[model samples]
Target: MNLLIAFLLTVLLMSGVWLWQRRSGRADWVDAFWAGSIGALAVFYAVFGDGAVEKRVLVALVAGTWSFRLTRHLAVRLAGHEQEDGRYQAMREHWGERAQFWLFVFFMGQALIAWLFSLPAWVVANDPSPAMNVWVILGVVVWFVSLAGESLADRQLSAFRRDPANRGKVCQVGLWRYSRHPNYFFEWLHWFSYPLIAMGAPFQWLAWLGPVLMLLFLYRVTGIPYTEKQSLKSRGDAYREYQRTTSAFIPWPPKD
Candidate 1:
């Protein structure tokens, strides 16, 4: 409980600071800071928490890798970009003058969600089990596969965007040809790896909730749905045609 409280307080306080500093227009910095802080906390827990060295090492390795990659990706994408995230910009427009308050609430909510989503890593790291098992090996393999898939998807999209020939056309080459949101698909797969690694440990089943909640958010909430709507508005018939031929969340052979 203390560990959880510490995590929550740290996130909330940092979010509050970001909220207060919104006047400076540094939301991206706040996002990067949050990621860095989470990475630091993972190391703290791995080293000082009352878990076996092996479990701590595993959790630290997985969580740190994920956090670093995600943070780097976001930082690269948002660097030198002044536009607010579309989701947040929409909220601002909807809320008008009260958008600041809503933004604070939203940031706080994200902080809470981040901590909740990270609970699997926390629990797994703190578990007493010291034995290496098949599940751990499987989890590592899944993590690598998901990481590679997501990286490839990001690269493919970046390359498509960079090519003038592909301007205004939907990306349908490489991984994007199969899944519209290959990055999101691999992200979901990555979470599943957590439960696999932590199987048989206490509260391990609860770890499954992380992936489910993530998929729900991605599919029904603020992920694919909003992004797709924006894409349809921007790309129109091209995006619609791509949608008809490509999977939304899963990677599979493109439809004929």
Candidate 2:
């Protein structure tokens, strides 16, 4: 319960900050700050968690690596980009004249979701286990693979975007050729690694909810649906053709 409270408070505080920044027309700063804040929280958990050294250290290392990689990737993507994310922009519209209220809800909501997603790590760190075992080894391997796959997918997409010859064309090379949202797919896979580490710990099975929620969000809610709609609007026929040939979330050989 204490952990849940801590997560809620963190979310509320971050949401308030986001609302303030959005009202002040500082969305870029808000996004960057949120990324940095996530990295900082991983550090905080590492230093302050009252657990065995091995568990704390492992949680810190894996969480920090994931946070840092994601933050850096978003920073690069948003660099010199003036448009707000479509999801956020849609929220802004929904809020009408009270956009700040909705912005607060949106940002803070994600913070809470992030906290939930990270619960397994926190739970594992709270355990008294002193020795690394097979589960730990498996978790580490999954984390490494997921992290590498997601990062590589992002890099491939970014490189495609940067090529002048590929302007206005759908990216169908490298990882992008196999999965429409390879990065998101790998991110979801990464969460399962947490449960593998925390298995047998009290309430640890509940951690499955985190990844399940994330998968639903990506497939049915705020992720691929919105992004692909925007893509279709912008890319038209090219994106449609790519969609027909490419898998949505999972990586596989292209049908074509």
Q: Cα RMSDs of all predictions? A: 1.9, 2.3
Would you estimate the TM-scores of all the predictions?
0.92, 0.89
Worst 10 residues of 1 by lDDT: 25-34
Candidate with top lDDT is 1
Q: After superposition, how far is residue 49 of candidate 2 from its true place, in Å?
A: 2.8
**Model 1 spans > 4 angstroms off:** 26-38
lDDT of 1 at 32: 62
How much is 47 displaced in model 2, in angstroms? 2.9
Displacement of residue 182 (Cα, Å) in model 1 is 0.5
Task: Return the clash pairs for model 2, or none.
Answer: none
**What's the CA RMSD of model 1 in angstroms?**
1.9
Task: Evaluate all candidate structures by whole-model CA lDDT and list the values in order.
Answer: 0.80, 0.76
